[model samples]
Target: MDELSWFRVLNPNSKNPDGHARSYEIVNQNYANKTIAEFTPHISFTNYRACQEYATANLNAGCPGKSVLDYVEEDTLELTDPVAWVNVGFHHTDKDEDQSPMPIHWQKFQIVPRDFFAQKPTITEARSCVNGPTGGAVNSTTRPCIATNTELPTVSTDTEDPTTGTTLTATPGAWNEARTTWNYQYLWFRDGEPITSLDEEGNEVGATGETYVLTAADLGSDITVKVTASRTGYPSGTAESEAVAVSGGAEPEPEPEPEPEPGAVTSKVKASATKVKAGKKPTVTVTVNATGVTPTGKVTVTHKGKLVGSGKLKNGTVKFKLKAFSKKGKYQVAVSYGGSGKVLGSSKTITVKVKKK
Candidate 1:
């Protein structure tokens, strides 16, 4: 048999037993008799039942004299049971007389390798420590120090400028000083180990600025910053700045814009009224006078606080008719232009009084 060839066994009663009808192939095959190398079989009830029934019925029908019987006995028959008479009623008593034979046969070998075991590495175990902060006098040999759980030591040095009235203070977080060169402004760490990368606080070993403009997204509680400073012609120094608490610094967001007021002026809308019968409709010619602020949107006309009609502003004014306002007392005419999120001009309220016909 190959490494993992599939095979099926005929054992109807064997389904109740473990590995009775399963197919398996040789995995090791290193034994002298190749017994230990043979892989275990996987037994399924359906296959076992069908195969055992077929083999039993064939044996019972006196069909052993045929070539099929010889092949089954030679290839599938167990040494303990020469006749290989499997009790069909072992698991299921209601055996079908018309049960068909399973064409699939159990093979001794397979082509694929067996999958059993594999491991992965964690982040801390995989990272390596690089060169980091060292402590010593200027021009003296400095020993490499691994960043541990302790807070980074502070390095400080100061110089008084005779020309300037200010005394220059240089901490580990300070940048401009008497030093020649610096790796970065701040120190980073992973699992208490000093990292040669920049820290989240922007303080490495030589960082300095009056005000750090950190992004709003980076503002959070427990955020810390370490300062490193160095100056030309002076010994370099490092210092841990006081941690800035973001909890108290957050501010409220601004309010949204309000809706535009009604009766706002857009382009000019000419107004004209004609007298008519009591029941008749009165034509109100609203000639958009001058294109005031040329409205870029739809114009709405209101009469006596009710929206009488609305139309797109074409050539500045739109002509509309009002039936209810034809015969009325006093009518308030208002023209509003502008949609949401936009501001348009507003006209003074126009009053029109209608007399009875």
Candidate 2:
């Protein structure tokens, strides 16, 4: 629609250019036949009377010198699946003259599909890349939107040993780096349930910050934290860390052990005396240690691949008296530990000197 027409042209000095003086017109259009040009195009879109109520696909039925709208008659309500041609355009003010056909002038227009297909056509483009490629459907050019988790977030804790009365700090996973640009929230869970506790004034409340102190109520319960990440134009995303168990005034127990590995235990063997009289038993002390926890089981002393003495591990250590030696000489004694399900076995050797009696 041109606003500068001779009759209905609007005055830009008094009001904004073509300040929407008229409403748009919707003419009946159809797929069965071609749409004839309007008898006389108007700045205000007024001319034909037949289009007042209906349009026909038959171009042969139109009369000479009559607009397509004039040829069509109104009151045709039986027409199914009616098509509508909506008029849409804007007024472009003319600029200074240009003789050498300046670069193509730009105009605003859109021809988009609406509800023509079961699903949006752009979905095909997004589906092509969502799960990698399939049969060369890769879209190299710009595809429509594909919503997915762009940022990964995870819950982090301050201490590995979760014990009663220990303060635990958690850092919610990251979304956008700037906290002011987006929103983030934290929720603590106990055994899959939201954790709730009392405030200083004895009012009950839920955890909201990055730090939570363990209490007696948390004893022996699995604790986990969920971090929700949010940013403008992105769907909210949440991630949770593996659970951490709180102990009752004791160090938290280690998780179930994987298949045992070799050399998980270290052992030292010591003798009470380096030299002794023949037929005198020597005290052999063996100590075994596993990091951070006491190891249980037994230790055996062997001489020349033969069993000499064996004792059970008590507090990760044990002592055994070697049977008296009949001959006088230096004897190589070997101390070995039969490991437990949690740790591998260990072996070490010591020397014992015996003198003739």
Candidate 3:
């Protein structure tokens, strides 16, 4: 599951001399084929073009040779409800240590939410230092600067996700005194810095207006509006609104649960006593093991297809105090494991003879 951590982005892979460079593929699903060579680069019988960086246009329509950032800008992300087909894997080479009695190697990667929650999801009241503070009094009681004659402008947005080109509105507050020529000048900010964007002519200019439309540049940044209220008789009184986060991304889904593969099941059965009194029950233990997985599901003691008794498996085994044999004769009992998804069921049989009391 993707979640926000203190470390959101990874530093340059080459920053660490010992670290291997990580690769990413964000495209269509026809990228992989398992029938051929191991980690094969599919060239033949494929029309897909290799991806390149910072391309102005998609030269190859069959398979655009653009990097993920370019692909997101020009094609896949333009329309709403779009999907980015991302595939991740680590290909390793066999070393001397990877031979028989080899040391197991594991690789891990994370895909976390970019901007899904309003606040940090890990924050809680139990953690008093959530924002890095203790419940103690401070030496200086600092407060916001306010004036009786001047009121701060309230900033609001149609949507937090600035990627949609939503409108940002700054309503003028009640400025009672020195009302005449109370000119309001607006300047947008991103993380406390004046926000600048390029026009159609590609010129940098400050975003200044009572109502401004959010640009793609505003995405994944903290946005705020600073409004300066001025009049002929009074000095300019500037007040800024609270900053809002524009991390316009969706919540990530959790990984699916793991289950054992079929055709590797090994079932076994053991009885406390093969011969028991007619009225006494037989203690039957059923064990079902699989390669690389622990068996879990229903374990049953049966006669032919008829279930004698059913029990749940725990830690790959289950014990059943089966119904006592009535007649004085040798009989067969089958112990079965009702399998789970992708896991084939298995059964074992044992002999139990009933003796007269």
Q: Which stretches of candidate 2 lie over 4 Å from their true place?
A: 1-38, 42-161, 173-182, 197-206, 249-357
* TM-score winner: 2
List lDDT for all candidates, in order: 0.36, 0.53, 0.54
**Which runs in model 3 stand beyond 4 Å of their true positions?**
1-150, 160-162, 178-181, 199-203, 249-357
Model 1 lDDT-worst window of ten: 114-123
Query: For candidate 1, lDDT tens digit of each residue in 1-357?
Result: 323224233434434222344332323222122232111222112212223334223444434423323334345533443222221111123346535753343323233322211111231311211112323323222221212112333322232211112222323433332213444355422111232326788755532433233333323222233445443222344544332323222433323323656754334445665654332345565544433344444555566554554555565566666533323366677756433223443444555555553
Error of 2 at 270 (Å): 51
Arrange candidates by TM-score, highest first: which order?
A: 2, 3, 1
Model 1 residue 6 distance off true place after TM-score fit, in angstroms:
99
Per-residue alpha-carbon lDDT of candidate 2 for residues 94-122, written as tens digits (9 for 90 to 100): 56665366446543323332223333346
Question: How much does each candidate deviate from the true structure in C-alpha RMSD?
Answer: 26.2, 22.1, 34.2
Q: In model 1, which runs have C-alpha deviations exceeding 4 angstroms?
A: 1-269, 289-294, 326-328, 339-343
Decide which is better by lDDT, 1 or 3: 3
**What tens-digit string does per-residue lDDT give for candidate 3 at 185-258?**
88987655688878999999999998877776666455667777764323455666655666654322322333
